[model samples]
Target: MGTLTTTGRARSVGALFAGVALLNTATVGLSTAATLIVAAGSGPGWSGLPSVANVLGTAAGALGAGLLLPVHGRRRVLSAGYAVAAAGALVAFAGALTTSLVPLLLGILLVGLGNGGAQLSRYLAADLYPEERRGRALSNVVWAGTVGALAGPALMAPAADVATGFGWPALSGPVAVAVLATAGAALAAAFLPRHVPVRQEVPVRAPARATGVARPLVAMVAAQLTMVAVMTMTPVQLENHGHGLDVVGWVLSAHLFGMFALAPLSGRIADRWGPRVTVNAGLGVLALSTATALAAPTAHTSGLPVALFLLGYGWNLVFVGGSAQLSRDLAPETRSRVQGTVDAVVWSASALAGLGSGQLFAGGGYALVAVVGGVLALLPLALLASRNGR
Candidate 1:
């Protein structure tokens, strides 16, 4: 594999970062708003439905992208996804206006679908660079989400104010923001360069068996499962403990910050130490974070925020590392299908976690959820250990 020219690389990376940032910003904002809406309209126990729908949408989008990218190419597929996301934003906003749970859920599901496609940016970036630099490329695109994640919730105040002035529901503001952001991302994607780097050329070597993808895929699934299981309920927990929406926003922002802010550093770590090591390290961090949250006496305590932040950070590390390892191990000719399948499975597991997280929290409490998550976090470690021993 050859290096991409500096200018070419920069242009491609910048475009990807911009598109990813916009979509992520919308997704995060929608996530917060959707949960609140569903909780108020339905019950706290059902809050996770929107997120579950979102992840399901993402899963569908990932699979669809896999099928489309090889035929229609990245730009067309990405732009279409954004367009669909924008439409979903409108649907969600309408749900807020009508105070109907159905529309809100439907809207979120569509947004999730769009987000699923946007998630492919990392894969695209990975393909654009040489193997040695693939981690950095992927992480850089992921890091772009830091901007969106932090700014997304901050926009809520103004959006709500505007919605109030317009006689619309408060939640409508954030969905509106999502619409504009996703539309902008769609426009940005439309201009992306179609020519991927020469490094993406499939090698002539005989491909390894598909079973080689299972290890990293499992790691990816475990990481996402634990992360979603905990994250989807954090806001509900805080609100239940008397914290206002503002505090929830801030806490979630912190968590999102952790998810994206240090992506570059994580990528570097993966490159330096190997993805397996990074994945293992992530699992440890997740376990510690969950235990900390479990140990906290109250939801209002400082431990919750700290735990959420570390949880997000741990998830980021594992996701990036596992993604790198998976990408590196697969043959380019079969990469798209394999990546799509693995992501679908991982996201499907996350979807299940999102669906069950609220019920778990309602039935048992955060401690029960955290303990279960901690146990799941350890599975990848055990698998990794077994693989190493073999």
Candidate 2:
């Protein structure tokens, strides 16, 4: 591949940022709407199914992207991913119109696959910059999600109203919004440069040394598992406590803000302090956030929002840090495949967490879920500590 000019790189990154922002909007809106649709129709016991399907779809998409990106190039792969997601959203809209669970789940699953592809855009961004600035570059894409943080849930009422006006299900409106947003993302992705400059390979010395990948991989999986488990149950928890959809939206907005608004800071931290320190700080914060959740009152409480926000930021730290670490020193040949495989594992684990959170909440309430999350956070911390001691 030819060397890309700085200006060209900047343009590509800008396109990716736009694409990511749109994808996040679609994802957030779909997730929120799907949860409510399922919960109302099938009861809260099955509310987590949407999330599980979404994450599993993401895992499949990511794995597919990883395998394809090396062969097809970034522009085509990413654009196609968004296109798939848009189609999935339309299917979900149909499901909402008919009040059908199977199609709804399938649609959400397809949306997740597209998300898996969209999420890999961060790696593409990293490819545009040198190692020294890779974290910041990658984070800029992650930060684009801040737009979705505000717009996704904020659009729910207006979108629903618009759908109802047309004699469609109110819940179908958000899925319609998702269809548009992902289509926009596909257009944005088409603007990405066809190729990125490949970095030099850093040789792996031994099997033991290659084990270094485990550190970041484990950190990411732990973070994803904890975040998904807690987040999947949060809306249900709030609703059970007599809070309304409006309240759930507000709390989710806050949490999404925490997840994306501070991405640049997380990137900077990963670049300057190294992934180890960043991951440690994230795990600590996660523990603290889960602890706060333990004390949330049955009635509406500011504490829930605070804890959820903390949970989000904590997840961001680990996610960015681990991503930065994982991107370092890989041969260009395997980069996309490695990233895709790692994300597949992370999202797959999160799917399980999503599935289990509902059951745990049903049996023991939110407290059990929170406690499990806190324990997950601590286990990674202990692993890091033991490694450092060695």
Candidate 3:
């Protein structure tokens, strides 16, 4: 395979960034809308259904992308993923109009399948660049989430108004946004080359003395599980304490900002200090953040935002570090397989977390949920320590 000029690499990366950003926009919008629709129809208790469904879909999508990327290349997989997500969005819209729970859950699940594929953008971005720059590349893709996370919720009101104007249910507006965003992402992905030879290069095997890939994979899964478990229930916790949707919105925005706003810095840290060190630091941060949240007597207190921000920041550190580490020292043939498997594990963990969070919170309150998350966050550190000792 011929080497791509710097210009070529830049263009490809730019296209990927755009596509991932758009895809995220759609997913975030869809998730928010799905929850609201479910809640309005069934009850507030069912709000977690959309999140659980989306995570399952994302796990499925990631597994498919990981399995297919090596054979089909990033371009086709990404395009197809966006198309699937868009189709799911349309189905969800129909469900909303008809006020049916089953179709909505099914549509949310389908959208998650596309989310799994879109998640590969980070891996592809890392693959596009040289080894030394992989952290930055991965971080750039992760950073794009900041845009969608911030905007998705804000669009709810406008989208709802637009839906009402069209004589449709207000919640249907978010589904419309999801359809448009995913479709736009697909259009952007269509411009990607059918084949990028750079991605097909042979792998560089890591030394046996080095930590095994399992360490990073475990780190990613642990981080994701912790993040999902705590984040999924935060809004409910706040509302239970008499906080309004506006407050929930502000806190979530803060959390998302923490998740993505510091990507470049986190990436740089991963590159300079090594993923092992970065991962350890992330674990510590998450442990502290969750513990802090657990100590809060009321969710409506000001301390909640601080704790959520730290939670997001810690998650970013671990995720960026783990992803960069995982991408190293693998043959092209195995890379996608490993990545897909890890994502599947991660999202599956998250799905379980999302599913159980509400029930757990109901039975024991947010404090117990935070305690579980904090303990999970510590597992990566323990695993890394054992690996190093060996």
Candidate 4:
């Protein structure tokens, strides 16, 4: 049979990849604002409000995982996620206006579902590409996501300014986010082929062996979990050092810069080195970042930011590795479902870390947080790095 190529397909898979950018913008941007506002407004600080965000985020993620199969197809699932996210944004915005925490939480929860599902954009890109180009193709799609991730938090300042000046609802940020998400989702729905998942939607044929695939999947999940855990705690760690909000914003941006700025190149690296080596290297960087955190002096305030940026580098590396590998392993028939399941596992673990981060910092202080995060970051890699064979 002839190889799969475009012509019958959409003009470019890249065009389809654009949907990921939109989803990332709404999900990441809204998340940034929601967490920040919650941090400021809630009584007990991260100890309380961020937990609400996590709870909502976790709930939404869980729901999305369950709904992925029954929702017609991947596009429909993604569209539904976007709509639910918009609803969440509206409710959250109204909550902020009315000073009702419940509504705000509900809004964030809706966005979280979209966030969870949208994350599978990488896998979608993988499905669109042939084996040879899959890694780079997945990277390009993830790179698109960075546009929104960077913009998301940056948008918050202007939005918060608007709320403060206009005497409108303090939740204007989500309102703006809702608009953007709605438009993007609609566009994605309209543009995406109604029938794209042709081979994908069918039932799967099992792979050669269970143990062979399980190790890599499990390793990738560990890498994902570690990346999220340390990454999540950075802001709180900085706050403990008396860093101001502006500093916090700058630090977060610096980390993103370290991460996505070189992501395209990281993808190239993974494609060349092969996924296993790339992922192992990623875990190494993460371990190094954690070690640095352990050594940072109590008098030094730079630990969190520096560590975050470096840890982000690890994430970039691992992201490229794992994404390509998952596509390689799974049956095309089961790709989206598998992607959803993998994300559910990764996000669910990270949610636990997110939920416990504040208490960890509070109880053990930044030092404990760093050490614990570091160990968790390194343990899985240590277990799997020997990785006898693919």
Which candidate gets the maximum lDDT versus the true structure? 2
Global CA lDDT of candidate 1, please? 0.81
What is the C-alpha lDDT profile of model 1 across 147-204, one tens digit per residue? 8878887887688789889999887788888888988888888776664322234433
In TM-score terms, candidate 1 sits at 0.93
Better of 3 and 4 by lDDT: 3
Cα error, candidate 4, residue 333 (Å): 3.0
Better of 2 and 3 by lDDT: 2
Candidate 2 weakest ten by summed lDDT? 199-208
Residue 105 error for model 3, in Å? 1.5
Screening candidate 2 with a backbone cut-off below 3 angstroms (N, C-alpha, C), the clashing residue pairs are none
- Winner by TM-score between candidate 4 and candidate 2: 2
Ranking by lDDT: 2, 1, 3, 4
lDDT of 2 by residue, 1-390 (tens): 235788888888898899889989999989888888888898777888999999999999999988788767778888889899989998888898998999888989988888998889898889878889988989889999998988997898889899999999988988899999999999998887777434435542331244346788788889999999888888888877777767877888888998999999999998998878888899988888889888883534588888888999999999888888867755565677778888998999899898888888888889999999999988988778778611
Alpha-carbon local distance difference test for all models: 0.81, 0.85, 0.79, 0.62
Query: Residue 90's C-alpha lDDT in candidate 3?
Result: 84
Candidate 3 residue lDDT tens string, 1-390? 124578767776777888877877887777766765665566555667888999999999998888777778777888898888888888888888888888788888888888887777788888877889999988998898888778776676788889999999887887889888888988888887667433545553332323346777778778888888888778777766686555666777777778887888899998888888888888898998898799873655477888888899999998888888877655555677677777887888888778777677767888888999999999768658876611
Which residue runs does candidate 2 get wrong by more than 4 Å? 196-211, 297-301
In candidate 3, residue 79 scores what lDDT? 87
TM-score of each: 0.93, 0.94, 0.90, 0.84
RMSD of each: 3.0, 2.6, 3.2, 3.8
